[model samples]
Target: MSIVIIQGPHAHGLASGELQRNLQPLALAAGRTLEWFRCHELRDFVACVRSAKRRASEFMLLDPGELGLQAMAHPEAGLGDALDEVDTPYVEVHEDASTELGIQPGQHHAPVATVIINGDIGCSYRIGLGIALRQLDDEGIAVRAA
Candidate 1:
C-alpha cells in the first residue's frame, strides 16, 4: 500500500518558512515528493484528506505539534470539533509513546495504530497528541488531522 505523509507549517509551531526548512530533510529521507497545501478553512482540509485516501492505499499523517497547540490556545474555537465532524481516521505524534503505555521507551513498545483526534497545545501539546495517538492506535485507524 502506498503511504501519504501530511505535515505543514500550520501543523508545526513554526511559520511557513521554518516549516519548509524542517520538512526539506524529511522529504528527502522519504524518497518521494509531497503535496503541500495551505489550510485556510476546515472544509478544504477535509477535501484534501479524502483526495489523499483516494490516491493512496495507506495514508500516514505526520502532524506537526502546532495544530494541536493552536487548538489548545483557543479552546473555545473547538479545534477538534471540525475533525470530529468530518468522521475520518487520523493520528498525532508522540514524544514518549512508552510513558503513556507504562513501559520503557525502547522495549515492549506498542506502536500507535489508530486515528488521532487532537486538541493539545503549548507545553502540554505533545501530551495531547500522545493521548489521541494512543486512542487511535488502540482502535487501529489511520491518522488524518486538519
Candidate 2:
C-alpha cells in the first residue's frame, strides 16, 4: 500500500529527516510504499493532497505546521475544505497539543481520523504509521513487507 506524508511550511527548518528516519521501521514492517511532501505554500499543500486523493493513498499523515493553523483560523484560506476532499483516512500530527492551539482534528467537517503525538514530530509519524497499518489489517488488507 502507498502512504503519503504532507508537511506544511514550518517544517522546512525542522528535523524532518529525523522524522522520516523514525518512520522507516514502521513503514517497512507494514510493507507500505512511502512518499513525503514538504509544502512551502498553502496552494502547494492543497495540490499535493489533491494528488494523493487521485492516487488513492491508503492513508495520509499530515503535519500542517503554521500554514495550516493559520488557514484553519481563516475561512477564506480554504485549506480545511481542500483537505476535506481527501477520501483517504488521515491522521493529523501536531507539534503542539490541540489544547494549546484550541483546535481539534476533523473540526469544521474535515475528515481527520485522529490527531497524534503532539509536540513530537518523529514519534507522531511513527505512531501514525502503526495506526494506519493496524487499520489496514483490520480491514483485511494485506500490507506488503518492504
Please, what is the TM-score per model? 0.38, 0.78
Among these predicted structures, which one has the highest lDDT? 2
Task: Provide the clash count, candidate 1.
Answer: 13
Scored against the true structure, residue 143 in model 1 reaches a CA lDDT of 40
Q: Residue pairs in steric clash, candidate 2?
A: 31-144
Per-candidate clashes come to 13, 1
Residue ranges of candidate 1 with Cα displaced over 4 Å:
1-14, 62-90, 93-146
Residue 87 miss distance in model 1 (angstroms): 12
Q: Which digits, one per residue and each the tens of the lDDT, describe model 1 over residues 55-126?
A: 642333434333434434553453344333433344443332221212122432222332232432222333
lDDT of 2 by residue, 47-69 (tens): 88778878889888877777666
lDDT for model 2 comes to 0.70
Query: Candidate 2: where is the Cα deviation over 4 Å?
Result: 98-113, 116-118, 141-146
